[model samples]
Target chain A: MNILEVDRVSKQYSGHKALDNVSLSVPEGSVYGLLGPNGAGKTTLIRIINHITAPDSGSVTFDGHALTEADMPHIGYLPEERGLYKKMTVGEQAVFFARLKGLSRSEATVRLREWFDRFGISDWWGRKVEELSKGMAQKVQFIVTVLHRPKLLIFDEPFSGFDPINANLLRDEILRLRDEGSTIIFSTHNMSSVEEICDHITLINRSRNILSGRVDELRSRWADGHYSITFSDADPVTLMEALAPMAGSFSTSADTRGRHTLDLRLLPGATLRDVIARANEASTIHAVNEAVASMNDIFISAVKANGGDTPAPVIS
Target chain B: MSKVSIIIGREYAERVKKKSFIFTTILMPLFMLALMAVPALIVAMGGTETRTVTVVDPDGVVAPQLVDTDNVKFVIATAGTDTVAASADDDATLLFIPQGIVEGDKPLRLVTGKAASMMLENEISSQIERIVEGERMKLYDIDVKSIMAAVESNLSVNTVRTDRDTVGSSTMSYALGFILTFLLYMMLLLYGQMVMTSIIEEKNNRVLEVIVSSVKPTRLMLGKIAGIGLVAVTQIVIWGVLIVGLSAAVMPALLPADVAADITAMNSGAGTLAQSNLDTDLLSALALIADPMYILGIFGILLLFLIGGFLLYAAIYAAIGSAVDNIQDASQLQTVAVLPIILGIVFGMMAATDPVSNISVWTSIIPFTSPMVMMSRIPYGIPTWQIVTSLVVLYATFAACVWVAAKIYRVGIFMYGKKPTFKELIRWARYK
Candidate 1:
């Protein structure tokens, strides 16, 4: 089930359109990735979903109904630029956010204490935010973001400042939240992490959604019809000559042990069996594997293929 | 609890718990007490010293009539006493009336060991001049007593308002009006800037987005202003209770019993100050201060204007703060909010001088200047309808300002990096 759907959302600032007819759906119990280069309107779309800003045109549906003020508590957002009142203590700041999310003071206090203990940050609870290390503050903000257990959680650039250990911790928590049936909209430029956790993604560029789908589906959809093959006791010349007519392109290289590997793309109407049958006539096959595109390659090629002329949205 | 109240609670608690708030609350009354007590202390310490003036009149014409005061003693010098020697005493001054000085061109010569004070000079010169003039009048065979009576009969105007039970001095009213106006002006500026600074801090901290996502920007902005306002009111109330209580305990101790009774009688509108032997100006001032209704009226007008004026200006200030990334960038935008407050003070001064004049009346009725202008006029007993009209306009304008400010603030807080111009702020306000 789709927990949130944005349809034809459009937002215009003074000089430019931040989002142009951008649309996406966040499915329940899945981690949805919002992929875009900086200034590609990912943040704008996130803001619109958070209701921090209104879309110039379009509608947002949350949990089977049009978005309203009452729906705010059901959504949690941690913006890219994390901040807390410097003079406020960590526990007080967290509880304040909880109260703002409609928790009673006692409930907030109890939940905050549990969260603080779980995060191993109870010792830092009474310390002011200004006194906390950057990583520590980010952890506190993370706790504040998920403390209410909102049905939908949006995290923008969630790993920008984390060290490897903490980043892994954050990733684990995010996946855990999804496992518990909370839909998540995660926006970031880190494609590897997206591949690791994101089930679905929408790539936005030039204020428009250029590409979107399930991560595995997109990888397969953009895959070239190429296979990497290794042969033993095979003559490179004979193998190339036999596969040349059936293959679109072919290359061969030898390692230090003098074992040669052949990489080739099949021509139209040629099947894997036909190519393998033809290659077997010339050599003994050792191993054969198909090559699929990584998300990084897809992202670069998709943005570049679209002309890449979209100047970054003026943030101010 | 409502979200706004939660915000308000945090805003208030954070500020009230600060050391600065506590210091300002306790120390402001002490500061004011020091200011009030310094002059009285100086007067009490300096009142006892008496100086003798030796009069060396060659003709002995003006020497007999020169009288002594509590601080100045007039002593007729013996004939053949050296004027310079007689003036050698540290506390004595020698006055020489030349022979035939009543009819001659020689000015009265005063010789003192040190330079005499202006007050002593005026006393001796005036005494000699009066006697000299009387001698001249006798030379003309004129009726000096009848002329003196005629001059003394010149009328002194005593203003009595038909609505007021006792006669009040216009100068006192102007002074009181000016004081109240100045207080409101200061509070509006101070508290309004406070609102702006707090907004800028939240914006700079980048916490505004997190909070705004939970509640409407309007509610957050208003909650902050209200919370700080409660802090301001708390400070004022503490200062008020301290000052009023101190003055109540101190006033009777400072005044003679009879004079205190007269002030109490005048406070009740029973004793006429015109019949008192005391300085009527001082007595009336005391009486006015003693009147509970008058002080309450002043306080009521003050608090009303303070809150109204603060909300009006603070709204604009909040908008300005949200439009910029930092306080440095806010400086230029703040002028728009500051200019009207400054203009209000100018209008207030005008109202103090002439509350009934067209400029004062119009400015007091206009919302932009009414908080200041109306505060200055209220002490002079302006028409009830004008007060109602002014207050209504002030609050209505405040509501409108908050509405527009919230619109601008809602958009401006999300914008980063560039400082928006006023035109941009207006555009932001127009965004749906």
Candidate 2:
């Protein structure tokens, strides 16, 4: 069952359309990824869902009912801009926010403490929010957001300020939430994080959804049947010469271990087996790995194909 | 938690805990004490030394009658090269009584270091005239007995008013009325701004979003107002108790023996006045507040006016906070809100000088300005109808402001990035 359905929602600001007939859905118990570059209307859509702003057209349905003001308490929204009263203590702010989300004081405190302990931040409860580091503040925000356990959770760039370890911890928690039957709509530009956590992805460009599908399906659909080969004593000239006829493009570089390696992007209808055979004919193939396009690659290709210039991908 | 209570509690706690609250609450009384004691101390240090005025009576008629007193020593100088300026420099005020031939044409000149104060000059002139009149009566061989009889035969009239209450007035009543009106006005303004500024700060910091999501906007706004209002009330109660308590505890120790005697004498005089003019029930009521019923009356009127006026202005402040996204924007609106309060205070001060005057009546009737004006008039004995009408209007204005404020609040809290002008706020009020 679909927990949330945003159908052809459009929001205009003066002459500029922030969200142009953008439609998306989150199935029950799924982690949905909203993928877009900067200023691609993801925040606008999230804000619309949160009822901070109204859509210029179309409607949103929650749990098979049309969205209304009453539905606000049932949805938890973690806005991109993290705001907390600097002078208020962590526990106070958390409980205050939780209560707004419909939790009683005792209930909010209990849930907040449990989350605080889980996040290893029980010591921070008495400290002012301004005294916390960005990641610590984000942890408090996360606890507040989930304290009431809303059926649907919307997070916009939730992992932006988290360290890698904390980021992984948040990822695990998000997955756990999904497993516990919470539908999640997360908007982020971190395609790798999306690739790891998102079950479904939507790529919005120029205020419109240009491509969206299951993450794996989208990756597969954008795959070019490429394979990378690594071998000791591999001569780049010989490998290139043997694969020239079948290879659409190829680059050779030495790996960190000083082993010779070759990367190839095959032409359309080319098979991974055909590249492997060509590489095997020239060099002693120590490793033959089929290269599947990462979400980053698919995102770039989708964006590029939809008339957006794909910048050089940065690998971390 | 109930929304309003929670809001009120938060507002109460947050404001009372602030350092500013603690500072003001403690400092105000100390300042007031210094204000009251400084003049009396200066006078005491100056001492009761008399200045000798040598009157050069060339006519020789008025000299013997002008007797010396502790406040002013009169010396009769008989034309022995009188250095008028030198004598004035030594003491001050050398009166020169010219040789007067006629009874009605007596003239005198005075010399002093700097110019003699108007009060001193008037005193000297009156003394000279009394002396000259006595001499003229003696020159006509009019016996003192016959003069006394003739003066006694002249009609002595008593004044009575039918429409006005004959409470008779005092300097203390006027002072009390001014103080009560001023204190209430200051507290309302000082604390109302505090509430408004706190809301604006929270909104600017974006913390209001979190708070508003949990508590309804109305609840949160009211809670803050109530919380701060409670804090203000607490401070006032403490100050009142402290002032009365401290004064009672320290006043006897601070007063000199002579001053205390004078105060006792004054109290006896007041007792006689009270016995003659005030009814027994009114006297008992006056005794309850240490025989300052006018002070208590002014205080009661001030309390009503303060609460009504503060709530009315506070509602406007809350509306301003909601309508504007930042403190800067709210500041622009603050001018308009403060104008009426300022006008009330200024006019109230002026009304204190003449509480029964026409201007005071008009000021007390206008709802916006009435709190201060009515408080000032209470000591001068306002009509019961006027107080009732002022209260009714103030309460109605407060309710209307709250209603309008709620509308602005609902719309304004969600608005960001842009500030609406006065015209825009009017439009927002009319928004469907």
Candidate 3:
């Protein structure tokens, strides 16, 4: 079921379109990834969904109802620019924010304690926000965003300040929230995190949606259908000559330790078995593995295919 | 149930809990006591008996009648040319009564260290006159005591006026007026800034966004103004209570009995003056408080003006806070908000010089200035109709300010990055 629908929302600042005819929907109980390069209008879309700025022309629907000012209470938004009162204590600030989100003081206190203890920062209750580290403050903000258990949660660059360990911890909590039936919309440049947690993805470029699908579907769509084959005693000259006509595409190189390895790029409508059968005919294959495209490769390919002039990979 | 109440509660709780509040609450009364006590202590320590002055009569013919008394210690210096310098440093006024003078023509000269005091001069002059009269009486063979007693004293002058009622000195009126105006002006300024700073802090921290999501902008705005206003009111009340309670408790013991009685008489006299001008006294038309009605009236009008004026100005402050992304940007707009308050204070203070003058009337009637001006005039006496008109205009002005402020608020709160100018604010007001 569609929990949020942003239809053709356009925003222009002095004739420069920040968002142009951008339309997307998030399925219920799904971790939707909004993927974009820098300045791809991802933040603009998020701001529109958060009702921070009105679209020039578009309508938003939440839970099958037209969105109104009253719907703000049911949606939690954590902006990329983290804001917390520096002079206020963590506990006081949390309760104040929670109360604004419609939690009573007592309820906020109870929930805040649980979240604080779960995050292992219960001792930070009395500390001012400025006194906390970047990651610690982010943790507090994350807890605040989710404290009231909003039906829809929007997190922008949620893990930007976290170390790997804390990043993994937050990632787990985000997945847990998705599992518990909360629709999540997250926008990030982190392809790895998107690969790890996102179920469905939408890529926006230049104020427009360029590509969107289930993460696996997008990966599969961009897959080259190639396989990597390694053989103990395979001669590269013989293998290349034997498979040259039927290889579709093939390249042989030595591994780091100088062992024989062959990489093949398959043509469209070709199968990995065709290349494997040709390589096996030349020599006995020790190992054969079909390559699956990672989110990074797919992202780069998508960005590149859309006339993006990024630099090729450079070896360090 | 109202959002304003919630805001008020929050503001009261957060502000009253601060250490500064408690500290100021206790410190002010002690400071006031010290101000009153130190002067009295100095005066008491300085009081002493009057100093004595001696007169030396040099002429031997008239020296037999030189009466020495406790207040006047007289020593006769013989009539000689060498005795003048010796008597100059003797802490005495040397009176040289010329020898061989007629009974009625006894001439005298006075000598002292530097200059004799007026008291010493007068005493010496009177004593010389008495000697001359005594000589005249001896020549006529009449009793000198009866002749001296028959001299008439200077006539006294009394004044009576019929055109105007006697009022207290303009100094007291001006003092009360200045004080009342300043108190209102300062409280408004202090709390208005407090409101602005609080809003800016909240906005900077992004807490305002969260708060506004649940509460309407109007409610939130009203709540903030109300909350900070309550805090201001609480502080003022605490200060007032401390001053009044402390004075009532310590004034009797602190002041001398005669001085205290005089002060009480002055207070009662001022009250009677206020009563004498009943038609002009604004307090007489209003419900009288148990305390001095004029003071109560002044305070009541002050509260109304402050609450109304603060709400009006604070809303603008909140709008300014919302419009700017940083404190530096807010400072530029602060001048716009602070200028009217400064004008009110300056003009209101001016009212103290001439409470019944035309300038005071104009200022008191002006809504932008009436809060301070009318407060200043309350001590002297203001007409009921003028008070009502001032209040009506002030309330109307407050409402108008709030409307304009809310317009700015709606646009400014969400605005970031761009600093808006006056033109832009007007444009934003017209945005939808």
Looking at every candidate separately, what fraction of the true A–B Cα contacts under 8 Å does it contain? 0.77, 0.28, 0.34
Worst 10 residues of 2 chain B by lDDT: B282-291
Q: Write out the backbone clash pairs for model 1.
A: none
**Residue-by-residue lDDT tens digits, candidate 1, B244-271:** 6665677556666777788887777774
Whichever of 2 and 3 has more TM-score, that candidate is: 3
Candidate 2 residue-wise lDDT, A1-316, digit = tens: 8898999998876447889899988888888999888878888788777765568799999899988767778788776666787887989878777766767889888888888888888999899989989898888887787777788888888888888999889888888887887889999887777877888989898899998788888777766467778976667878788777777567788877767878887776667787787677677778877778898878787788888767443343
Ranking by lDDT: 1, 2, 3
Q: Judging by DockQ, tell me the better candidate of 2 and 3.
A: 3
Q: Best candidate per lDDT, number?
A: 1
Candidate 2 CAPRI assessment class: acceptable
User: What are the DockQ scores of the candidates, in order?
Assistant: 0.66, 0.26, 0.31
* Model 2: lDDT to the true structure: 0.74
Q: Compute the lDDT of residue B58 as modeled in candidate 2.
A: 64
Report the TM-score measured on chain A for model 1: 0.89
- TM-scores across all candidates? 0.87, 0.70, 0.74
